[model samples]
Target: MPDESKLPISELQPDQIVQAAITSHQPWGITANLIAYESVGASLDVIRRGSEPGVKALAMNLPPVGTTIDLAIGALRSWHYEPWVWVDLTCP
Candidate 1:
């Protein structure tokens, strides 16, 4: 594993899998804390494609705060100048 603490957000590449701890519940998804990059925030869209409706429903139920999950880096997005990590649900 790379030195997570020293890894800059800009250095994060797509398709890299990482563990993140869910921090809060969102109506549309969940907000997570990227375990490797403290400065970056992660989000997962529970209703995304590739999963069945039932599976999506289960995911939509939401995990308790602090639940850790494995996710792949889909893309980096900016919101008001802040960087956000969008997890990929398409990859296994």
Candidate 2:
């Protein structure tokens, strides 16, 4: 299997938010609110899966929501599977 840790950061680009409804697992029925950040903060709601193209593309796209003014607040306060792992979600 490919080493996820070795994946080059450059491979990930055009960052955007995706709303993924957890289909399975303990959090089934829950929604995964994902945020992709560049230098500034931007937010979008995922609407449907496979609507886009890419890893995060598997996640559905939704309406553009509030701009993440506070990184710490948005992340820490939101319900995430693993917030620490999310650090890479926004990183380049």
Candidate 3:
């Protein structure tokens, strides 16, 4: 399991942006939150804890934030919150 204490707080850069998703166990059951990453080394804080499942844990690499390169719930199940559908973040 990746340590949440080491999560990074640096702002994301243009090249870092990636199609990402955050999943957690909530009262309704396992849920996923889709998000966009702006950098390779960025941190996504857990704002609120779910009601039922109570968010027992979270897993993601996110550069300096964690050690593991990929987030996984167990031995097999893993989620890649990076390298999703690439898009232009420079245009207004």
Please report, in order, the local distance difference test score of every candidate based on alpha carbons. 0.64, 0.27, 0.29
Q: In terms of TM-score, which candidate is strongest? A: 1
Distance from true location, Cα of 86 in model 2, Å: 4.3
lDDT of 1 by residue, 1-92 (tens): 65656557776678787777888886666777777674675777665642745336547456689888776677776655454444333222
What lDDT tens digits, residue by residue, belong to model 2 across residues 1-92?
64444433233334333322222222111123333412222222223222334324323322133322221112322324533232212211
User: What's model 2's overall lDDT?
Assistant: 0.27
Candidate 2 vs. true structure, TM-score: 0.18
The lowest-lDDT stretch of 10 consecutive residues in candidate 1 is 83-92
- Model 3 clashes, total count: 6
**lDDT score, candidate 3, position 4:** 46
Residue pairs with backbone overlap in model 2: 45-62, 46-60, 46-61, 46-62, 47-60, 47-61, 47-62, 48-60, 48-61
